[model samples]
Target: MKKIKLLKIFLPNSLEETYSKILNNPFKIGAPNGFEPIKISESYACAKFIEEVISKELIIDPFGNTEEVTSKRYIINEFTISRIRNDHILILENPSRSVRELIRKLSEILGTRFYASAIQIDIHALSEFLSNNRDSIHLKNTRALLSGVNLDKGSSATIEITSLKDAIHDARYHFKGKTFKIERARFTASSGTKKSTIEVRSTGLISVHGPDEKSLVELINMFIAEGLS
Candidate 1:
């Protein structure tokens, strides 16, 4: 699964100047490659994905290099930062721990400190959406893992759905006489006769396992407007 990170960049008031700085200076290093910006429409001015080459000091080569000496090794931290015609939210493709430096560089280029956070989607709302739109979306979420504080005891529990896929759309599994609210779920969605699947996690990572561009866009829009805080 491809893990993408979403960031809400706080740009300086001079939006035009910020773009000019990014277009010219571009916190990017090395030669141009596939991450280069392309024109989509007039809604967006410029978009560029960055691949950073960083070198780390290796105490000893783990790949059979002689342990007698330390050397500098290079690695590529790749991620695409697309404005996507949306200034409020910045999409980071395949984010990793090293991506924090990329975010810092961007904030420096913008001359402002932008905060980063995982785009946490409300689990309950998402399940509600899927359950209501059953005509276009056919999916199932089993083994809902719930974690919360009740009274004075904090607990996490996992429950299973014993019914068929068609009957598991209730959002929460009922056991005995209590309904357990699901706090985390993996939604696998595909339209009628389509083989591709779109996966949305409650942890705020939106990954598309298929080539459903239309659905991806729709989901992103919904996420941008309602997902991030």
Candidate 2:
């Protein structure tokens, strides 16, 4: 017999509890790769189906960041399943653009309503900023500032990496009169995950991993916003 499972891709670490709750719903539907939604609720059965359908473990690697690989393993942390009458209401946390698009498309086809958020920013301008300031200690200080603010206000910033050639070019041409050169740039969001570190290279790239694609896109968008602002 064919196996069945629930495969949900959410923005990394964004809606932890919300997704966990959704996973608990016995009546929740399952759709693989945009296929028709299937209803199932048994965690054990779902686990078996997931094992059979997805050969490798669900691991999201962005920008080749090794830290994400070393972090915690993926497992159902906590959940609760229940149902409500017509007077009942369901609430979901904010989601990324891609996630929203997928959900919207699914709802449209299925004749239902789904909601998601699409965070936006400019990658090119941010890249230009990092490229121009390769030697500026201020860039590092900016990271420190943002990191401190995250600690205080509880938020994240997005970042990017660049190649050495690009860094040098920006430093020589774009930031000729500037006293500082930025060696790297990174964007991130943190919620009490201590001792987080990001490394930006000269290739004009930034790397991080989300629990899902939506989270990854949100992280990238966050970095762009911070870099430009």
Candidate 3:
């Protein structure tokens, strides 16, 4: 089964001039490869603020950067995306490229200070049954896995996992009384990304947080390699 995971690196306050350059000069900054800039907005109380998503196509090592373009969407973090809390976060949504490769590339572009905090990885894996056998699945499993459970499009469940192999099992145990056809599941802690059509489908998500940067990298590597094994 193909899984979708997110790695968000929180950074310090961006230099105003740098932020401005990203917002204003997107074309020169580039994107992952074919992705174009989409306008992003922040919400507070009742007001909304629009901010340009500074972006550029990144070239993965071994492959290097390519001028060849395709329509497939993959938006890498050009700069950090800010939440209302004023925390600047560099978010890689449903990234398929190597996280380490991305980090190196971003460092070249934005410098190391941009990744001021430990990296946060949100692990996601949806059942093969979801897209393959939607009609036959039970509502209980649907609600248990997906937020705002609906027959149509909706939000995904964000739950953390301690063990990737037992993700579905954990979910079943956690939501024991809930009716569902799925046999396993897992969840993560609370946390939070943008644009592009990168879809992260999971019955549960494992969210990593805290200040321990060393352990954080280990956990990220573990999940990336063994999460789906």
Off by over 4 Å in 3: 1-4, 15-18, 23-36, 40-80, 84-86, 116-229
Best by TM-score: 1
Question: How well does model 3 score by local distance difference test?
Answer: 0.36
Pick out the ten consecutive residues of candidate 3 with the lowest summed lDDT. 43-52
Q: Compare candidates 1 and 2 on TM-score and give the better one.
A: 1
Better of 1 and 3 by TM-score: 1
Q: Candidate 2 — what's its lDDT?
A: 0.30
RMSD (Cα, Å) of model 1: 5.4
Candidates ranked, most accurate by lDDT first:
1, 3, 2
- For each candidate, what TM-score against the reference? 0.65, 0.23, 0.32
**Candidate 1 whole-model C-alpha lDDT, 0 to 1:** 0.51
Best by lDDT: 1
List per-prediction Cα lDDT, in the order shown: 0.51, 0.30, 0.36
> Mind sharing the TM-score for model 1?
0.65
Residue 84 CA displacement from its true place in model 3, Å: 4.5
